[model samples]
Target chain A: MSAAGGLPRTGSALAIWPALRRSGLGPGLLMLAVVTGLNIALQPDFFSGASLSGNIATFAPTILICVAQAVIVLSRELDLSLGAGVSLINCVMASLPQDKVGGPLGVMAIAILVAILLGAVNGLLVAYAGLPSLVATFATGAIWFGLALTIMPQPGGVISDAIGDRYAGTLMGIPVPLLIIAVAMTGWAILARHRSGRRIMAVGSNPQAARDAGIPLRRTKLLAYLVAWILVALGAIAISAQTLSGDPRLGTSYTLASVAAVVIGGISLGGGRGTPWGALVGALVLGLVTNVIYFAGIASSWQEFVKGLVIVAALGFMVLEGQRRA
Target chain B: MAFTRRGFTSAGLGLASVAALGGIKPSQAAAPVTIGLSNGYFGTEWRDQMIDASKTQFAMYENQGLAHKLIVQQAGPDTAAQIQDVRNMIRSRVNVLMIDANSATALTGVIHEAKRAGIPVIAFDQAVTDPYAINVGIDEYDWGKHYAEWIVAQLKGQGRVAVMDGVPGHPAAVARRTAFMDVFAKNPGIKIVWSGYGMWDQAKAQAVMATVLAATPHIDAVCTEDGMGLGIMRAFQAAGRPVPIMTGEAQKSFLLAWKKERDAGHDVHLFARSNPPEIGRTAVGVAVRIAAGRKLKPLPDNTYHYPIKVEVTNDNLDQLLASVADKPDGYFLGEYLSESELDKLFV
Candidate 1:
């Protein structure tokens, strides 16, 4: 699929297919198409207003986290703390004193700052302190989780209606979830066009070479983490809006699931590969798998087994395609 | 992956039949009611049995042509996912919505939306505090209190008791912990030496119990919320200590384990009560009735407490054990009201 990279584009509708396939998004798109087709066939009304919106809304947090993880993964680093960061932000948002200035908005502004600070801490540990990303983030994840539990011992605090409605409502026939997806994609596109983006890829590809070539390795990596945390904070906000309540454990699943989504999106765990678009498709594929399993009347006992098998098979397919390309 | 042509044909036929059924006016006035069960968490064996029992009841109703099949959508432990599961069920226009809520308050907004959509929602197993929905479950606080009373009596009102709780801050966990703590306070002799949260999983309970055992050298009794008692027992066995006077739930595995311990000449005094899985079936029945325009006798708090099945002690252990001898390990040893039995609650 990468063969289309050096070829001149005809700039036609026919050319878009090969271009998408060349970006390593091909396998993810295929999986999404097949799974979504199966879902629509089984439920028939799967694309109807409420069902479609709910599907996207439920999976939007995962999509946002996927991109966040992609940012880190593209730098040959991992941030296991993103999930806990999201959880901490969610709890903080909910537990914001009702009498505080500006109420939820003030709480949200504070949360965004906290997210950036959390990201900066991670960046310092990995880039400045020279700690291995895995162990560093894991420890930070526990710290963040403990902080979240401390902030909201129970999952009971409320988010104001203004913020909740803004996240959950539709606009001009488009679901809020779709809007969130658009924002993430657009944000990534802008980042990819910037110089720091190229530096991140360079660092991931060969850090020593990039350093010798005069790139600021530490700052570029830190920038990637900063951007990733911003997305994660948005993810936390999305989760807060959807549930309209605070949970200390709200984002626990996202930690590993985001990584799973990144790999499934055709991104290499070794890093410096794949696109954010692929991550988007990968998240949608995972979401549809659950819906298809339910609507197809797969027995409850076998549901988890089937889901695992499908994911493994898709991963295998991606591997084979990668090998064929080489 | 099993998207076969015949499956598609049958699905089309099913839709056509549903549409045909929707179009017709039955002289007998039977409406093909669709009930949706949105279960939030599947971490426990109790949930498996609960879903199994509900499905069995739905099948029985379908066989009798009382309703269409129940649409069951199970999600992970995430609150947002479960809320979306409820929304998806609503989108399908299920006549009734039944939930085993992940949180008491997290899904309130979504439940309100379901009610606004003309769907009658019944919260069972995990009752929500939402006023609009029909709440059904065991009185968790009383369940804890009764067991605590038994433990206090077994200890003759004085002992170093260790308490094992379920997920901290969970509504049922909170109620159970409060009731047990209250009961312990009432009995001046009952001193809780160590307390730990077990999250209601067997392995988690076992690990927590091991830690508690390490910290406090001696315990007169172990008071554990059900589902995790078996694990706590395992911790005792692993440590090679005599099993203390313990409170267990009505899980078949625990009953069998208790009997085995008894047969092995271990002097163990245990009491277990029903936190029955059959409540799922009861909730399904209630949802069906409410959707059919039947008026239910309203309780002041909008909550209906189903009867506890059995409280097993040494005297009654043999009978309870024999009743579930042929059942699976995960089965809960309790009874729920049959369909006709549930009918009396309605006007």
Candidate 2:
């Protein structure tokens, strides 16, 4: 298969080469290992079950959004509103009165619906209105954020102790958050095998060529957005559970974090070129770096400075790898 | 050549210095205590002052054999990161956990976790909702009420007031704003025209005030908290409007501005209160006392309201200025209760 085949073929000789060349998985995984090793060496409790579960639970939201962000990036688009989208869902879910609004389950259901609707809005703006995904999502993200602020105003709302406990709980010896992450990755792996999945890659790789090949360009992009929004909603729910409260400004950090994770996972920003699994690993890498930096006893003032340096170095490595491949 | 043999002499000198520090009272020495300060917000002058005051207090404690070490970790305005910082402190087994919580309710879970481990958590400045944590610092409601009363007095019970609050919904901001609202409501004639949050940010407050002034033509007094008072004053000056009778905080810049305006015959009726960053020091004092198995004064609530020392007006402006005269421009003229004063809280 040609390198231009967009999506990698599963279980073929061509599969390994294309996956190796386009996905950037090998380097991303390597970086994950190095960071994990550093963290383990520095943090004595890195392997402790409680610590592991807690860290992963904290990281679960970022991991989920990275998967969604990877999909949007795979389709040659970006969703700057993913964070605000999560914040909106969180605020709404929190604001709903369990007694008057049919309880937490009903709130969850409505949250998912709102997520899909938000995705559709982003899709319509990008696919029909012909606005740049960057600008469109940015504007819409601000709107979502504003709406969240209006709904919650301050960071106060009860998300019930039961849901909060479950979110931070373990399931059959595995952390529930880890299980959720596994399910998201497994779902993506299955989806990426479908025909629509192939079209997503093709649309991202060469939109003009995909149209020439009779691909439904608009529908594919919209589908990608809808899927991404659903994933973002999942992340929102997870954070809401973890916090057990609604914060209007919650998840504001996820917008850039998602993009950073995608880039670090070896996904190219210019087009479709990487796997969601790589993005998952990328999220892990960032989480581990945070741990390692803490354990390293670096001065607090320089922690942010060091984190930025690490991310920039990861980006530089990706660039160099791309240059080598070409 | 003599250095190798003199190594023991140097070690002896080290021991002598230790003995000198230990001379305060050997009976007071017990197992060295480790205190961790987990600060969520950074870069603000108030936060900087708070940390500095705490560090200075720690040094004093170290000399007095009260504490062995102080570990401070400050991250940006992320609650998750702040939680992680607290957890890290827990893992380090700090004897007392002092946190300036970013959220009123978000840190409850972790605070409970710390409690389970027998680490007494003290939430200061910005408090947490966790019942297990001993919340400290000035009573935010009273902090606001003092200024609100002044505003009411200045306006003679009725005036159009614009309120600039801290981070909206922040425990301190909420309490302060609520207190102000209650006072205004009771006065009946007092009308609040506009209110916005500065997020306790100076530049943001200045900008917000500028726009608010543009939209609202008639304004009698501006009610604001620390960190934003100077910005609000700057906004008034920028708009070429006579600075209104406003409530202020004990920040040096604001005091200097008050003095400048007063000296210029501008009739600046500024009633300033001190939100002493020294609460950080008092928190350490409280935490160390609690960790030593000492009992605290009984309180109706979990909160221990620290005392305020400076409530400045034109009458006391000279004294306040003299107090901070030798200090830098950014010095916060706030007082933390001395050890003797804090002793009153002990059984």
Candidate 3:
């Protein structure tokens, strides 16, 4: 059966299968494995239950944001505001009275709604208003950060300790953060099977061709953004749970980090080529690089320089792999 | 990996050098302990100085066999990254954990984790809001009050003041802002003509001050934190406006500027205090004592307020200038509590 807009596809073959086989997932996963091995060598207890859980809790937000950026990049667009969006949602959820909103669940609903609205704003600007996603989202990011600062100027607000404990806790011998990541990946899996998902890739792959093939480019982009922002909202919630408080600048490092993860994940920044799972692996690779650096006892001053060098090496490897494939 | 091997070899070489320098065997009274320092946000010279001072102190401890290792993990201004750094420290089984926190409230969970792992956590430079962590830093509120009070007195309880602050949401900056605003609010005559966040950055402060100078017809005094004082002075100088009475820090650049004004026969009314980065060294000393099982003197709120003792006024400008003359412009002139002074903090 055709997936969308008469795109050729077999009924049994899933869209993600092609994406997984075609993109940078292999190299990204390989990089993650190598880094993990190095980390384990330096830190023998790297995979201890407590250490694993703690590491996953710290990594969940970045991993989710990487997937969020991947979704937008896969649609031939960008959302530079995802990090700021996380900060804004974090402030909103932490500052608002959970009791007034009918407790934790309601607060979460509001956060998700805010995330969708933020994504829709970017979608409308990029898809409907025809503004460059780069410039459009950059402006919106600033606005979101400003709004976040307005909400929580001094980084003091309370989130229930229960939430933080549960986030750091384990469920059925599996870390809660690991479960959250699984849920996100599962969500992406379902989306990859959807008609809108195919349309997003089609639009990103070649907008003119997609238009000729009768795909609603604007709507598809909007849907892509909405999906991506939902993921970001989840990320924001995860981070809030970890922090257990509101800070407007908590997500400041995420924007560039997300973009870097997408590139490292072997997703072409030009668009339409990589899977969110590849981005997931890329995020893990980045996290492990940090772990390895710390465990290796690199000097504080040289840590950043070393991180840069490692990332460049990863990117160079991907380039060489891509060239050989071609 | 080759990198891991090299890291161990260098670490080994460092220990050998420390042993040679010390010229003494490891003490048997207390076993040498590993100390971990997790610092988030390394963008400024102040942070660099803090880390350097901590390393210097750690090496001294290593030489004395109080500490066998000092593992430092410095990351960007991301809470999660810092938390991860702290967790890595815990996993490495450091006997003590010292943190220069990025966010006061955000690190509670991780600090708890460290405590549960039976590691004593000492937060310095910036306090964390965890009950489990012992806070060691200057009283940021009083630090701000000193600046505000001095500025108010110089203005004789009245003047148009332009207030330049550090990062708005930063804990230290927030405390300082609250103190300044409270003092300003109590006084009826002090009018705040302009205010903005300088992000604890000199260039950003300079730009903000230049804009304030352009828009405001007159600012009787500029109340600012350290690190940005020199920039504010330059802003006034560049605009060809007479430099006003201002607050300053112990940074060499600002101190030098104050001296230049005094030499030029310009009476510069400045109050420069030392928010010493050497507190990093002091915190290490405290951590070592705690790890040695020394009980600390009971304190209110589990907080130790390092005294803000060093100040540069018109009175001692020459002496302070001469002391820091050989230092770099970014050098912060201050002192850590000596080992003897730290003894008073423990029972």
DockQ of predictions, in order shown: 0.50, 0.39, 0.65
> What is each candidate's fraction of native interface contacts (fnat)?
0.42, 0.30, 0.81
Comparing 2 with 3 on DockQ, the higher-scoring candidate is 3
**Best-matching candidate per DockQ:** 3
Model 3 chain B scores worst on lDDT over the 10 consecutive residues at B1-10
Report the C-alpha lDDT of model 1 over A76-162, residue by residue, as the tens digit. 899999888988998888888745748767867777798999999999999999999999999999999999999888788887767
After TM-score superposition, what is the CA distance of residue B81 in candidate 2 from its true location, in Å? Answer: 1.9
Against the true chain A, what TM-score does chain A of candidate 2 give? 0.92
RMSD of each: 6.7, 8.0, 7.2
Docking level of model 2: acceptable
Q: How many residue pairs clash in each candidate at the backbone level?
A: 1, 0, 0
lDDT of 3 by residue, B1-347 (tens): 01111222232343433333332232354456899999988868899999999999999988776788999888778887887888888888888899998888888877777767778889998987777778899999999999999999999998999999998778888899999999999999999999888888888889988988899988999999878888899999999987899997888888888889878998789988899999999999888877765556677787899997898898988888788778888999878998778877865
Place model 3 in a CAPRI quality band. medium
| lDDT per residue (tens digit) for residues A1-326 in model 2 | 44435554565665566556556776777788898999888878878877788788778888999999999999999999988898899889888885676676777788889999999999999987889999999999999999999998888787776667777787897788888888887877788899898899999989999999999999999999998888888888888876777877777888888888887788888767888887788888877777777678766887767667757876887887766656
lDDT of 2 at B230: 86
Candidate 2: stretches off by over 4 Å: A1-21, A99-104, B1-31, B158-160, B189-194, B197-199, B211-218
Q: Global lDDT of each model?
A: 0.81, 0.81, 0.84
Candidate 2 chain B lowest-lDDT run of ten:
B1-10
Best by TM-score: 3
CAPRI category for model 1:
medium
